[model samples]
Target: MPPRERDTARTRRTVLDAAARTVAKQGAGVSLDVIAREAGVSKSGLLHHFRSRDQLLLALAQDQVDTFAAEVRAAVDPADHAAGRLVRAYVKAIFDSLGDDTAISEHLLLSAALSTVPGVAEILQRDARQWEAAFTSDGLHPDRVLIITKAADGASLATLYEGGSNPAALERTRELLLSMTRGEGSFTG
Candidate 1:
């Protein structure tokens, strides 16, 4: 890319990273001035990139969803059954995020706060619907797919909130969920 474009991208990334950390630490009500200070950019510079507070929040929310989707895609294996691949990818993504110390996961955990901003919730909701449709369209029964997905989500939430290692339980739950996807076990919920 051109130098000017590269610098612009770099600046944007720095600002976004700072914004995520500030919001995660300070909640969604944090001021743009604080974010600019954190990013080491002038408030005018921050505004030049994001235009407005709502715009910045929307960008942050979209970035979170995009990052999550990329993680899931990386974890997925094309040879696996579609349903199994989706569930495994999601579970793996959650675990991977939990293990990361870069604060991206913390930023994502602020989705509830982001949702309060005008367009952020819609972005998240759209991603959820897209994932739901993907799972439902897989050959597996929709109810089973949903149950497995919900279970994984619950496990992820528990791990995120509790903040500790319970490798045995997590492994067992992963195995059980994978087994269900493979048609090797029955689960009702």
Candidate 2:
């Protein structure tokens, strides 16, 4: 890429990183001025890329989803068990997300918005369904596996973000989730 284009891209990335840090530290009350300072960019330059704070937050959410999908897709094993692959990918993502302030901030904002915004979860849910269908095609019951996996993921993400390394709790939850997914017993809500 040309120098100017590269510079612009770098600036945008810096601003996004800064915004993610600010949001993670201060929640949604974070200010654009703080983000600009964190990025070491002038307010004018930051505004040139993201016209408004809402736009910046939206971009952060989109980037988090895109990065997550890419990571899971890359981690999935094509030849081995798909259900196991899904669980591994999900567990890895949830625990690993502890180190990612961007994803943390993005999820906090996106989940809140999902309650108020109709289409917020539509695309992500569709993508999740498609992935679950792939597992079902391998002979596992999609609905049962998806429910357990989603619950496991939720619990893992919550623990990780809360900085609570409850390994025993996580291990028991994982075992239960795997057992239910494997249809080993009569599991219920």
Best by lDDT: 1
Q: Residues 62-85, candidate 2, lDDT per residue (tens digit)?
A: 665777778766765677563456
Off by over 4 Å in 1: 81-83, 100-105, 159-163
lDDT of each: 0.78, 0.67
lDDT by residue for model 1 (1-189), tens = 999999999999999889888888788899999999999999999999999888998998898788788888898888786446676777777666544433435745576678778877689889989888877656677777788778876765654566753667777878787778775655553
Q: What's the residue-level lDDT of 167 in candidate 1?
A: 68
Looking at candidate 1, what is the lDDT of residue 48? Answer: 94
RMSD values for the candidates in order, in angstroms, are: 2.6, 4.4
Which 10-residue window of candidate 1 scores lowest in summed lDDT? 96-105
Q: Rate residue 20 of model 2 by lDDT.
A: 66
Full-model lDDT, candidate 1 = 0.78
- RMSD in Å for candidate 2, one decimal? 4.4
How many residue pairs clash in all the candidates, one count each? 0, 0
